[model samples]
Target: MIKNEANARHLREANKAFKAIKSEKPMTDYAKAQQSIQENRERLKAERLAREVSSKDAAK
Candidate 1:
């Protein structure tokens, strides 16, 4: 019954994918790997500050 169902379906799927990929900020593998290093530095800094606070409290 449908003459252009395959073409129409392909169009719809392609259009649906366009939006999902549109807003992505592409990062290379090295960039993605470096992000974790920054995160770890932040985490370690927070942990060091927490320990310092606890040590000061214990000293008092």
Candidate 2:
């Protein structure tokens, strides 16, 4: 059936994508630095949001 063929094609594409991701090399130092910065930014943003919420609750 046509549906079956489409499903097979989708699976093949997905497998190829997974293989490509598995083949990637390790991150360079610059990439590591960028990832570290991104993680720190996310952590800081969460802290800032928590502080704002607490302050708003206190002011009520």
Candidate 3:
């Protein structure tokens, strides 16, 4: 037979997940994204430099 404890545990988990997702911020629009353009550019620049460094090291 199913037990009351099992049902409570399931409900608690479901509600916890629901609350977490509900609390998260939604996607940002282009204007909001542009606000972070400088940060994004720096991140991409760092990635490209890292790749170049690795390639030069491998060539040696």
Candidate 4:
């Protein structure tokens, strides 16, 4: 649960960063957006793994 929450927090932060970058000058930085997206994906994967483990333990 804690890991899930942390992951969510990271995602939210990434979203904010994306928005900020998007709102900047005319040119948008695809690299920064891509990095943030990748980080978000990794965090989500960690959260999913944690949930899977917890669920499996509960089932047992």
lDDT tens readout by residue for model 1, 1-60: 375998898899988887565576789899988998999999999999999999999999
* Number of the top-ranking candidate, with lDDT as the measure: 2
Query: What C-alpha lDDT does candidate 4 achieve relative to the native structure?
Result: 0.90
The residue pairs in collision within model 1 are none
Enumerate residue pairs that collide in model 4. none
- What tens digits encode model 4's per-residue C-alpha lDDT throughout 1-60? 999999999999999887755455553599779889999999999999999999999999
lDDT of each: 0.90, 0.95, 0.86, 0.90
Cα-lDDT of candidate 2: 0.95
Clashes in predicted model 3: 0
TM-score of 2: 0.62
State, as a TM-score between 0 and 1, how close model 4 is to the true structure: 0.53
lDDT of 3 by residue, 30-53 (tens): 857886897899999999999999
Best by TM-score: 2
